[model samples]
Target: MGCSACLWLLLSLGCVWGMGRRARETVLGTLGKATMLRIPPELQNLTLHCGEAMWKRDTEDPQRKLVLLKYSGGNYTNFMQGRNRFHKLDFSLEILNTSRQDRQLYEYVVSKASEEEVWQIQLEVYEPVSHPSIQILSRVLANGSCAVTLNCTTERGDNVSYNWASQDLSTSGLCSHNGSLLHLSYSLQDASIACACTASNPISSRVVTFNSSECNYEHGGGAGLRTEQLVLLVVVPIVTVVVIIGVFVVARLAMPRASPEQEHSSLAEDGTLHTIYSQVQRVESPKKDPTTVYAKVMMPMV
Candidate 1:
């Protein structure tokens, strides 16, 4: 029973090794470029005898055979051509004009008499990373240093990621980052503060640099409004109120005025007059009113 157990352990180890040997390898490709799917020498040697080899592609669609070769009488012949764009080489397969749709798993199958072996290759295609650009999102004063928020961007890429690099970050303050946004609080007195952003993908990478000296600390660093804006906010309303008062005083000075005595005199001059009348008889009744009568009249103020 002990001897059988030893044999079983050896068999199990062999099976594990065999499985490891068949593990798929990953290959990266750039969009609109050509990539080679190279077969290892061990699998390439399998074609020396009366062996037949075939390549198959597996994707979201059904599995499809890419190419087939038959070796007989110490010679190889192409049995099938799956696609025109695929070029068969001595020890590898070349795919031209790779696209994102071409990313998938591929199997290289070799058959020799009664034995069959398979190798897998995973292909991933990506667009090359574009040049990155940096922009200052905002700036403010924190304590005595300038706190700035920066943003990095790229025009186009596939599976793109951003990483920032800087020097003497601890001297300024704790630096924090989130994806493409970087926040830093640094002092202007601190020697030149510079930061670099690297945008990368599986196939290509790009980098950009920014300097903190470009920040307009006097203008943007203030937590509140600027002096000019504050002056406008406060002084403008006061000036407007003063202007309105001056206009009212000038209007009052320009108008005509009349005193009570002048107004009363004007009214009396324009009003109707009052007079006293007396009648005397002729000489026949002269004796009765021979004596003259006098009367005094008073006028009322208007």
Candidate 2:
């Protein structure tokens, strides 16, 4: 039968059996964790006196029963699947290694002396949230104001919602949008702000913090530079100057040099010089044209 028809039938049975009370509850369970569905204190006595207690799942197959407990003549009997994973203690149910498939609507039925009591519970199972991480999407500096965009995400989480908050709650400059995507704009003169991103589900939560000053550096536009970049800027030019000076000194030392006296002595010993009165006579060349004349040279005393 359909779920609605099954619910109608259950309601009809409760009415005909003179149901005493009905209670509704919601329980949250984390994946792979144990959770307890407890019977209210006021209903514990009624459950103990009940002749039959059943835990049924509300689904297309309304006859699907998860657990059944019967008490007769001071003896108790129970039926369920996965005996190792589920336990009943004083009418309370404990589930271990919960999974997403365990999320469902369940009904606890108790019958005693021709009266019935029902507790309808809705189970919501969620994966525990992992540590959230922040990614800087973009950063801009315009007119002394810095605008940064960030995205908050988790590696593993189910049914998680994101919330952003500032470490300093009194700060008026903090702003965020789009839940997981945060956009913040602040003046450079403002104090550095720390932002926290929380990823939470019904069962678990995780938070991550980021400093706005991390994105304050602008590579081409802003005047601010990271510490390492500033160190490079200062140390690189000094290193270049030292290298240039060393190279100039090495080049100067590699060249050959001579003293003034040594230069003069070398020129004299080569004998490539003559005095003005060294040539005394000129003779005509007989083997050549008569007009051609040659001079007879003589070396002057040094």
Candidate 3:
């Protein structure tokens, strides 16, 4: 018996299923590559009755016809070119430089003395991965530190992965993975350091780097928003309110002191003053009406 797990060999380029008829399985191969799809190599040692064995292919015709092989009567057919060669030494079928057209289901029918057994195989192809790229969420911070976020992506990578690396290929300190499989985050204190991101797939891999020094943290506004800017924006309003309160307290202490008896009294806080006065008046009737006339006096105070 063949190792069930070894029957399928997964490679960076593709896959190959190496097994026999008793344990049938699918075989994966890359395009433009030759592969050996055998039923069971160990079967050669078996002492079973061998009547006749034939190879066949699946067709998409409306009749669901089965296409016979180019080999018949232990001789190669005229239509059988150099692509499909049969090695009479072990009766093995070799398909050379397989193409997309060759990705399909194939069968080998065997006729024995007691019963017949049919072996099947399937082939699949996949495209290789492409060059990857990196994207940073925030490149700079206000305090010269960098809270960096890098995202890696490839053009043709299947289920691609991402990882963060530093100048010496070390840790960038507390990196985290997002719900999105493509993105990664790192927090760096020194903006002068360098970092990189690696993206890979089964077929290929790529790496991209980011220069931390290029991300300068300007005092007012940096290349990207930083965590420290919130403090700067908040401090301005707080300082303004403090200055206004200080000015009010100083003005109140500088006001003048006055007494109530002084003329025009004392000046108000707004610099306005009010005053008060007292007076007396007298009146006399004509001498000719001396008998009915008398001196009259009036007093007025304000």
Task: Report the alpha-carbon TM-score of model 3 versus the true structure.
Answer: 0.47
lDDT per residue, candidate 3, 1-302, as tens digits?
45644432222112112223344568765556775666664332121224256556667664574544543345544234576766654555667877777767777655444444567777665444566655555444555444544555666745567766665535455333432122333344433555555666554557665554444432212323454566679977899999999999999999976557553433322243323333323246444333433433332322
Q: Write the per-residue lDDT of candidate 1 for residues 29-141, one digit (tens) a residue.
A: 99988888878766665544324666667756474555444444455555434431333344466776788877888777766445556788999999999898876667787
Q: What is the lDDT of candidate 3?
A: 0.51
Q: Rank the candidates by lDDT, best first.
A: 2, 1, 3
Query: Which is the winner by TM-score between candidate 1 and candidate 3?
Result: 1
- Give the better candidate number (2 or 3) by TM-score: 2
Clashes of each: 0, 0, 2
Local distance difference test, per candidate?
A: 0.68, 0.69, 0.51
Best by TM-score: 2
Estimate TM-scores for all models.
0.57, 0.60, 0.47
Predicted structure 2, TM vs. truth: 0.60
